[model samples]
Target: MEVDDEIGSVESKVDGVGDRLCSVFSRSHWDSIKDSPHELWIVFVLKLLSSYSYFSFALVLTLFLSTEFQMSDVEAGWVYGLYGVFSTVFGVLCGWVVDWLGVKWSLFFGAILGTIARLLLCFCTAPRSAVIVLVTALPFAESLGIPVMTIAIKRYTHTSNRTFAFALYYSCMNIAALVAGPAVDASRALFSDGVTLPLTSIRLSALRVVLFTSAVSTFITVLVVFMGLREIEVNEDGEIMPYHPPSRQVGAWKATVRVLKEKSFWRLVLFTLLLMGVGLVFRHMDSTLPKFMLREFGGSDDAEGVPFGMVYAINPAMIIVLVPLVGMVLTRVDSYTMIVRGSFVAAASPFWVALGAHYWAVCMFVVTLSLGEAVYSPRVYDYTMQLAGRGSEGVYTSLASAPLFAVKLLTGGMSGWLLERFCPEHPPPERNAAALWSIVGATSMLSPILMVILQPVLHPKQSPNIIPPVLNSMHHLEDDNASEGHNSESSNTGESDAEYQTGFGNLERLRRQHSSSNSSSSSSS
Candidate 1:
């Protein structure tokens, strides 16, 4: 009753805000949004812009290393892998920054670092050193923003709408990804003819021009954060929660350790490891899978970009469409159950890709993988929020990204090893690529399977031997229903029993008719 009343109050307040604000969209259109406060929309725009900035430069960075710097696969691994390593480490540490400084200052610090990194990428030409600066600086910037973003989402929305909020958030990330692919091509094309300075007569190449644009994007993002956003703690009781002063560095570290010592953290860590492995396989769609397609399948480099970009776009496209629908259905299901199911389904997508001899097969892979992604991906954070406490949001959120760090560290070099081992640099004869997918698919799929198998043991509530209250309640309902049937039969001179029989007959008849219609439709189609 309290929750219901609170929701009602929140709704009325939000509706009033929506009505008062004049905008391009009508009040009804604003109402159609997930009933969040106006402040959250501001945060949402920040997320969209931040994602665009991150992916735009990142999409081309690895390729630049290999093509421009002539870095070997192993050397490039450090360029890519170390960023993940440091980011993951910094993410864990940023818990302190987030807890103490709050989103405003943390983001302030991030913007500064991001601005510097973007500027360096725009002009720096020394191969190893430039890449190293970017890898280090980029994570330093994101270390604050990434976890803080999740904490903000958790703060600004209620539980009922949190998953939907995550969908919107994840979709923005995907939209960035969707745009980044084409943006890569567009950036490449913009300065292909080369650029001459107005008076200095200095020249610049296509890559440098693209990096300059990336720097501009970062600058715009910094402006948005500095001018538009306000930092606050979670909302409660028709009031904004005041930001409580968090502990200093040492104290924050102690608090983080204390949080980790709890059983839920360990359980989450175990589950994260399982889920992250599965994610590594799926995320390769962006990282290595394109290179795989270009090498194994025969197509000109120019044409390959379009198909691969389309393939990257498809996953996010499906996610944007399906997450809300899947969320509604999975609301009653346990998070782990959803994770288990999604992992198994994702495992098969690569199997189909293995069967292929063409680029279309990669499209098929994205289609199959996306369904499971929509179902399970949002649960990752939902599960984290459940485990975390109030100010400790940063600590837990960072830990949640542990899988991303782990995957980057493990898979960056591992991909090259697999490619060389299975596909070969130049094959004596075309080898079976099926074996490659089978190895990755099977190995990756083990994580979630292990999670499902271990869930009952780790969490008592999920144990099969334990009877749920709902099942016990249903038994009582059936008993009362049977008693009522008996009473009706006794009161109605057998007419009620006859009516029951008639109802059952009608139900069976309808079922048969439905089956017949389905068969006819199938045959006709």
Candidate 2:
């Protein structure tokens, strides 16, 4: 959140400080966001603090392992990959738990868990213990917290502002990451080597200083969620709905099987899988890219050189600038189209690095990648929210990460091997940097291509409206079934494929056809 020098320049030109501030943003932007719920802002704060801690610590995690524990690049990559794999896996587990625990308790539990994990990392000196602490504790921290926050945002805001709410939620994460870059560098510079504890003869590395600060932020998140958050249900049309706790909840296994039985749920899984290669790009940014930059480009903060953390920050910073603008401008476009087009742009990003190993090329790669992520990533949440059934938002949203489970699972080992071969610390004279990124870029390019090829099969054809037509029609059909002597449980399981395919207009036609058939039978009799 540091103000750029441009703010000072604008201040000098404008009549007053308020006018300078006003000039930076248009009236329309402010007006559009005026009615957002107060809880949404709390969610933003929680997102900022929690994600800041996650990314800041993440930027240094591989370095921490390599330096503090004396792990090799390959070893660190496996552990780092394990961290990501478990994080997503736990996210799926936690999503089901959220349906049982409710949003507030889930947030509280996740924040406290993150705090404890950071504290554990601070004290652990051995590689075995550190790995144990990380793989066990930290994975559960933000993994569950993110989905809970997404559900919180969905509940707090009306449909009118919900999309922007998601975009802003994502922006808060980038803003955290945006600030984490300088913080990472400053922390590194402040402790040129490492700092010692006052009493116990324990030494803290520069990275641990960042970790400790993140722990404090997570502690603050606990306080904020406990004191600030409350339950508020918002219906599809922006109406305030009464909150009702389910009297009898199904077992997680049964609930999961129920969600899996739905064909649409399978489509979501397929879509998530198709996007996995591009998804691995994000995994590489944290697990592989930092080490790649330090080894290949060297870690000098200068005009000719770039620091890894600073380079890491570039993506989030551009995303912070671009997400709101994209959300605002692309309201008319379908989420499927946005995802496809944006994946193409993002998939092309690594080619910039393939063309050259210079800092300029790295900058181009990150900036281009950021632009594409800004276009598509927030829509991911929006699209997931659309597919989610009324009471199963957490389950459906978390299930989206199931495909990512396999993505991160393979990428961890894959990244380690790639770095060893192409961008190793000890270089063979025949190192091939272009081949490294060419592989990554080519892998990512499959997403958009397959997405286009599989659209008719996977994507639902619906108008680009606040609520998707299939979900809307499904809700209406459920109500009709309920009034016609069908119980909720029966309606959920007994619906045939034809009933599920009834789009908004087709649903009305089905009702008319049913009525006409009934009348014709009675008259003939």
Candidate 3:
């Protein structure tokens, strides 16, 4: 638990800094979060470290494979595209592992895989590591760690703070995103040829240095997670709740069978599909775009890293800046409204690249795309959290990856092939821009349409607030004056808030409406 002590010490230092900076906000805002548990802070640290490694890996992947294996754009695409496949497949397996061993061990195992994969990249040669093997193994290792942290956040924070919890998670990820870009660019410049150590006289390329550093960082992350994380149960209102620890805990396979049978779960599947479709466009920027730029625009590997890292970093940087503002504004709107409108903005970004004629178009694409992503991405997670049941966040969250799986299977594999086919070697970037982007754009546009069509069938009259309306209403009852004021206006809110809010205590019915849960509901604190 040395890592736990280290993290705690770091948090104390940051707390002092954070408090002084936050003094600009009104005191009430601080009061709401002043007493947040230490466990949530731990989750934030994990999010930051995990995202740093993941982003750096994504940033350098195409270049690494190209430089090392002498693979073509098409070949690099498939190897890189394999991440989508590995992540989709491994994400599910990780959920089961979480069910068997719990969140901490699931995370540890995933990090171990990632550490080894990155370490392998250090010593890899065209013949030694083998293209096919690295493609599959690296993705498998990296994908496993993602779900555990998300599940932990879900477990640790209740309805009262989930919005902020996710915001904190996203913000930390963006800070990493901000750093990952610089890391990639620096690595490229620092070791474009190779670096030699004075004592050992070992030389390594910038690529290997970055790759090995990532491996060491990931290994340290595994240790941090092992020593620092402890499971905490939470109820819907952001209150710490008792652990269920059911004597006969259900397995992931059974959960899968039951989840598949539920009509509500099928609706959940539809939502996942739509998310994946949009994500395909978002992902192309990482997996395919870097290689595409080098082939079409004509630059050395290190040079491309400059603008390419900015492209990857910009999206999350905007996300970090916009998260609080988006949360403040969008929370007043309905989920259906935000989902529809946000997807509209996101789908338009890639087409801009298709229409433009410069290297900077990619930057524009990320800027426009991130605006929509900021609004919708967290909502998608919130909605999925709504769909999960007692002690099933791990499994339900696992289902979220199905969309990425679909992207990998369907779109990811095709991206490289299209680039290879449409943009020939030594051609201008514009040569393939319209033909390739139009197809990507057309596929992306379908997601918002699907979301709009599925809304009524899946979540008829669903509101923006994910907090079970009853729990929200019940909180008002604790205050006599507030309850009286609420009673006076209950009729005008449409459902006679009095009747519906009162009746919402029947947790079984709410589960039926939001998700199909067979187990007893965990009542809100």
Task: Specify the highest-lDDT model's number.
Answer: 2
Q: Which stretches of candidate 2 lie over 4 Å from their true place?
A: 1-36, 197-200, 236-242, 245-251, 299-306, 460-525
Alpha carbon lDDT at 320, candidate 3: 85
How displaced is residue 212 in candidate 2, in Å?
1.7
Could you give the C-alpha RMSD of every candidate to the true structure, in order shown? 14.2, 12.1, 11.3
Q: What would the per-residue lDDT of candidate 3 be over residues 342-422, giving only the tens digit for each residue?
A: 787788788787876467787788888999888677666666666665566666666656666646755656776777676
Whole-model alpha-carbon lDDT for candidate 1: 0.61
Model 2, 179-279: lDDT tens digits are: 99888888877776778867778788787888888899899999999765666676534455555434126777777778888776877788878988788
How well does model 3 score by local distance difference test? 0.63
Q: Which stretches of candidate 1 lie over 4 Å from their true place?
A: 1-37, 188-212, 248-250, 297-306, 399-407, 423-432, 457-459, 463-525
Error of 2 at 148 (Å): 0.8
C-alpha lDDT of residue 150 in model 2: 81
Q: How accurate locally, in lDDT, is each candidate? A: 0.61, 0.70, 0.63
Instruction: Tell me the TM-score of each prediction against the true structure.
Output: 0.76, 0.80, 0.79
Lowest-lDDT window of 10 residues in candidate 2? 497-506
